[model samples]
Target: MTDQWVSFSKVGDAELVSLTGEIDLANSGEIGKAIVGRIKESGKVLIDLTTVSFLDSAGVRLLDALVGDLLGHGARTRLVVGERGAARMTLTLCAFREDVLTTDLERAAADLK
Candidate 1:
């Protein structure tokens, strides 16, 4: 498996987390930790999953946990998913909230503001 990487940056008041490669059992916990850490740093976060090549059940669980954590902290999170991919499928199959999912990066960033 190709090692997954999560890069962090900022867009207005929202932190942008860009995930690349794949997310599975090996790295989902690490990924979740990174995302939670960012949320603790910034109250708002936008997770960009456009470049993520794959996401398994572990990955989906990671995302779900992040969302729950953010809610508990009263922070906001927006997910920018690719138009098509494992990431998108996982979100869909899990019936994630449509209002929080989008394919347009610019729009997602703007909405965060």
Candidate 2:
């Protein structure tokens, strides 16, 4: 089993959700819930995947759902994938929209404004 983890912090008007470890089938739902929960509470969210070491198809699905859910709620959301992060490969393979992708948490938060 992958040891997945997630942490959340407030940055200005956006909530930064930092994910670490491997995001796979076992934890993808929880990860999605945590992110959506915060978005429900804060309205603006920035997901930082810099510390994440692995991301599977499940992670891609979670991100896609997150964007759709956020759009339905009329909230802004951003995704940050560090240049050297492991999550990059999965994200790139999934072809997530460039508009929602950033390289740093700070940039993601700034753009959420």
- Candidate 2 stretches with Cα past 4 Å from truth are 1-4
Candidate 1: tens digits of C-alpha lDDT, residues 5-109 = 798888887888888878889898887777666568577888899888888889888888887777678777788996898788888998987877888678888
Q: Considering summed lDDT, which 10 consecutive residues are worst modelled in model 1?
A: 1-10
Question: Which pairs clash inside model 2?
Answer: none
Instruction: Give the least accurate 10-residue stretch of model 2, judged by summed lDDT.
Output: 1-10
TM-score of 2: 0.88
Task: Output candidate 2 Cα RMSD.
Answer: 2.3
Tally clashes: model 2.
0
